[model samples]
Structures are given as C-alpha cells and as structure tokens.
Target: MFTTGSVDGTVERKAFFGSMIFETVKQDDGALGITTGVENPVPLVILFLVLTAVLTMIQAIYRGLKQRREQLLEASDS
Candidate 1:
C-alpha cells in the first residue's frame, strides 16, 4: 500500500519520465514526416529572415534621407 507522499512522488516521476520519452520519440530517425498538424518550421524561419532584411534596407534609406536633409539645412543656414 503506497502512502500519499509515495504516490505523489511516483506520479511526479512518471510525468517527468513520460516527457523525456516523448522527446526521444520525437527525435527518432524515422519520425520526421510521420507527424500530423506540425509544420517543418524552416519556411517560417526563412520568411522572418527575408522580412528582417527588407526592414533593415528601408531603415537605411530613411536614415540616408534624413542626413541629407539635415546637411542641406545646415548649408543654407551657413
């Protein structure tokens, strides 16, 4: 007969081990294309990289225009 504390400990251990087993199964060699509902995840990463590059280019252009305007104002004021 298991006491309450032992039962609780066993349950916690089981949960921990269960998660480890699940992760191992997920990483198995033949597990790549067998899963459902989950995507490959690489395309989303590529999309983010492309968006970041575009935003960086836009920021560079805006900064260049701002600096040019400031230079023009300084030249006129001098």
Candidate 2:
C-alpha cells in the first residue's frame, strides 16, 4: 500500500513492504529524501518470473487445443 501527503509544499510518500514501512519526503530545497526498509527482493522477483512463464505455457497449450479441435470439425464437414 502507498499513501501520499504534502507538507509546506513538499511531497511525502509512504510505502509498505510486508510488515515494514518506508517514508520518503521531498525537501523544499529540492533534495530527495528516502527511507530504507527490507533490502532483499530477489526471491519475490524470481517467483513472479516463474509464475509468469508457467501461465504463458498453459495459455499456449489451451489455444493450441482449441485450434486443433476447430480444424478437426472443419475436416469432418468437408
């Protein structure tokens, strides 16, 4: 989840990661401010990539089956 606020013309942002929360506020002097929370996100990234690949394969297989069924029907009609 994310929330944003403004203080004296400066923008403040809050982000949540699991149970950790990080806050970032832009300074009025035009400097960037950031707060760090958890450091490693590699495992989450890898999991998402693997899940995407599996879903793509499943969709491709379903599409191929539908196309094959349609071709068989067309052949029977001829």
Off by over 4 Å in 2: 1-39
Cα error, residue 69 of model 2, in Å, equals: 0.5
Query: Candidate 1: minimum summed lDDT over ten consecutive residues — where?
Result: 17-26
Tell me the spans in candidate 1 whose CA falls farther than 4 Å from its real position: 1-37
lDDT leader? 2
Error of 2 at 1 (Å): 20
lDDT (10s digit) by residue, model 1, range 1-64: 1122322222111222232211122223433222222234555567779999999999999999
Q: Over the stretch 12-36, how does candidate 2's per-residue lDDT look in tens digits?
A: 3333334344656566686657665
TM-score of each: 0.50, 0.51
Minimum summed lDDT over a 10-residue window in model 2 is located at 10-19
Q: How well does candidate 2 match the true structure, expressed as C-alpha RMSD? A: 5.5
RMSD (Å) of each candidate, 1 decimal: 12.3, 5.5
